[model samples]
Target: MMQNHEEHDHHENGSELSEMQLRVRALETVLAEKGYIDPAAIDVIIEAYETKVGPHNGARVVAKAWSDPVFKQALLANASEAIVALGLMNRVGDHLIAVENTPRQHNMIVCTLCSCYPWEVLGLPPVWYKSAPYRSRAVNDPRGVLADFGVALPADTAIRVWDSTAETRFMVLPMRPAGTEGWSEERLATLVTRDSMVGTGLPKNPKDA
Candidate 1:
């Protein structure tokens, strides 16, 4: 009887998964039929984001900045140019701005109107970042949103929320974790996370890394 129940549960789970895939395919078909989206173009974009471009690029940028104060200064001064120095200037990165999170100030990014993310640097925007609740709350109540993401800041810490637009996008430069004064850029890059760049989470601790 237990074996039969387990088999039935597995079948149900697989059925649900297939159903979700079908729904996604149907949506894609409808969008394509209406000429609102090109399936081939989408495939290319997805492949680029998933493989050629991603958080690794952003991580490298962060690592370099963390290790070099001069580069960090240049980054804060002209983020778009600084990132171009790292070869991530094309595709939704025409105007990029880097906001630093300090001891007294926290930074977060949101696109209330649309999901205008820094795909060139951070790759795809996470599902949560594109959600209605996060969009509304990230601007309306940033501290509360951070708390929901399990990011606790001091009561005196000021939360700064940056709204992204079609023309400009923002990336959060999270504070470097302590106790790793001589770490290599390659090692430090591993500590930087997608969420940390998006301002929803912090960098991985050295021990955790």
Candidate 2:
């Protein structure tokens, strides 16, 4: 009976893997036929993930932290449970933490060991994010790296650099941009960019662009 159960489990796993491959192949075929997928279409996919599969988990947390002081405290104290409380615990690994960036202290995240991230919330890390130069320089010279990204901080502001190891991953809770008071959550989410979450850029106001 034990051997039979093992075989059944293996079969089910193989079937699921096959289905995933088929879906990937279909997507590749569509991309090939189009010659190039629109960047806006990628945004649409990201939006769908945020709505359906919950890709904007970190963004939602940031928004909540902005509005609620208690939750923000909890997030700072224990990010893994705080995020799980927000219904974002379906991802693969554990050890997810949130770092907040304030006016006085700016926080940046980098994985020197590997490209570890909170993908359930932030989606895929950009190509530059995973590049060796970014990983190496971000921790050694954060101000210089941010300068390269065109993000300038005041001389009084202190930059806190967090290194993500093999076990724990980090995300940045960006300071809410100015001039976006009394906005709905949906509208606020539009301002939260991947770069902002990665601590490379600030959230852009609708009026700015």
Q: Which candidate gets the maximum lDDT versus the true structure?
A: 1
lDDT of 2 at 170: 79
lDDT of 1 by residue, 1-209 (tens): 00111211111222222477579889999999999999989867765655255444888889999999999998998888987776644433567889999998888887643235786788777657878999777766777888898898888888777777556688999999998799999999999988999899999999988
lDDT of 2 by residue, 35-126 (tens): 77665576567556543443556667777777778998998887878877877565534677788888888878776333266666777666
lDDT scores in order: 0.77, 0.71
Q: Candidate 2 lDDT (Cα, whole model)?
A: 0.71
The residue pairs in collision within model 1 are none
Candidate 1 overall Cα lDDT vs. reference?
0.77
For model 2, name the residue pairs that clash. none
Error of 2 at 23 (Å): 18
Candidate 1 global TM-score:
0.74
TM-score, one value per model: 0.74, 0.69
Candidate 2's displacement at residue 114, Å, is 5.4
Best by TM-score: 1
Off by over 4 Å in 2: 1-54, 88-92, 112-115
